[model samples]
Target: MRRGFKTEAKTLALELRAEIGLDAYSPFDPYAFAAEYGIAVVQLSDLDGPARHHFLKADGSALSGALIPNGTGVVILENDAQPLTRRRTTMCHELAHVVLEHEFGVSLSDERKCGLSGDQEAEADWLSGEVLIPSDGAFRLARANATDEQAADAYDVSLAIARWRMNHSGARKVMQRARAKWA
Candidate 1:
């Protein structure tokens, strides 16, 4: 991700969290967040075959999710066959696109048919990570020497995501510094 874009995403994540009344350590509810912003969340299963196929890779691995522009609002389509954790991440990602007001196109050749530029995808991915596992929450867990499992449990995220966030969000560094101070 570009440094400037990541900074913007982080700022947006914090602002969204505050707008939704989320505390530093609380698990973010992407559905509620979408609802607050007047976006609709729909399951891929609810769509017809053609529409479903549009969001799936030929290998059958889900595309995770997609954001479709509606009449003034947007609809988020999530692959429900995946695990809940995956669905949560996908929803957050799609919602990130909406929150950032990324453009969409009418043609399939468009990136995921959503006109998301490469930079937009990176920003959304980073922002979604922040939304699912806020830095403050990661730090709180790290301060307690929490394991990846603990971070997953605390944030209701997948273990892999927890590990990434704990390692990459500067939480581990903060924890080490706190430990040094105590020592």
Candidate 2:
């Protein structure tokens, strides 16, 4: 997690708030915000559809969303009946991709390439996390959890995303030790 990304994410969140007439740092709703921004929204009935794989691609590889060039529209998979928290986080992640303008005329295949070494993706993920789980709130949740799953459920996000946030928040060693002891 870079300082710059955090700064930029907060900045963007504020800008979005003003643009949408939301109070500073109000709860973010991707669907509403996307609509307000003049970006077309496409809903997929396939989010809950059984696929032969682990991810559900909305535009590119996996269940990720990409903003079309010039911010024309945002394509997202509709995760019907999924936990609200999970849906919110995923939407936020897609929004991050859009806000960062990652879809600037690039082919979908070229954009779907995910290798762990990519800082851009990491930055986007970080931005998504920041926007969804503000730092103070995240820290408070992390402190009360007995397990990663508990934390994930509390935050309405995936365990991997929760774990990553924990690691970045300096709670990794404690959380890991707790898990090891309990496991």
Candidate 3:
């Protein structure tokens, strides 16, 4: 994570949520967001041939998702074979690329690779985290002393994502300080 990327992501997340008319604690509907943004979300299985192989792999090194440029809009291809939560994360990541208006390379592989530049990937990942689990939502859960399981349920996200958000979003520290003060 860069020095100010997290802050930028947080701001962007909040603005996007507001633009989409979502509450701070509501589960973000990536599909709805994509629809509003004029992006199409397609499943990997729905594709044929090489495109399918590019996203779904027999090995675990499969791509989670990719954002492809259309004529004027964007198309998001997700590996739907994965769990729903994973798919959601992938969608958000691709959506982050769209929202950030990242320039596409000439080849699909350039934009599709799992290993993008560190800063780009980090920014997208951080923004996707904020999109899925807003800072305010994390803070609310943390203040309630919510477990990772609780956060996952509340946010409709994977346990790993919930854990990361709770720990890294400044929520856990705030909650801990509040608890200490009360004690």
Instruction: Write candidate 3's Cα lDDT for 48-84 as tens digits.
Output: 9886776654764556777777788777877777788
Segments in model 1 whose C-alpha atoms lie over 4 Å from true places: 1-5, 105-117
By TM-score, the better pick of 1 and 2 is 1
Quote model 3's TM-score. Answer: 0.87
Q: Write the per-residue lDDT of candidate 1 for residues 29-120, one digit (tens) a residue.
A: 89888888888888889989997787777777666666677888778777788778877877777777777776642122211223465777
For lDDT, the strongest prediction is 3
lDDT of 2 at 26: 42
Please give the clash total of every predicted structure, in order.
Answer: 0, 1, 0
TM-score of each: 0.84, 0.57, 0.87
Model 3 segments more than 4 A misplaced:
58-61, 105-113
Across 1-183, the per-residue lDDT of candidate 2 in tens digits comes to 565777677667656655667643245567787787666654444434464133454554343333334435555543433545656665676666677766432212222222233666676677777665555445566556636676666555667766766667555566567779999
Candidate 1, residue 168: how far the Cα is off, in Å: 0.6
lDDT of each: 0.76, 0.56, 0.80
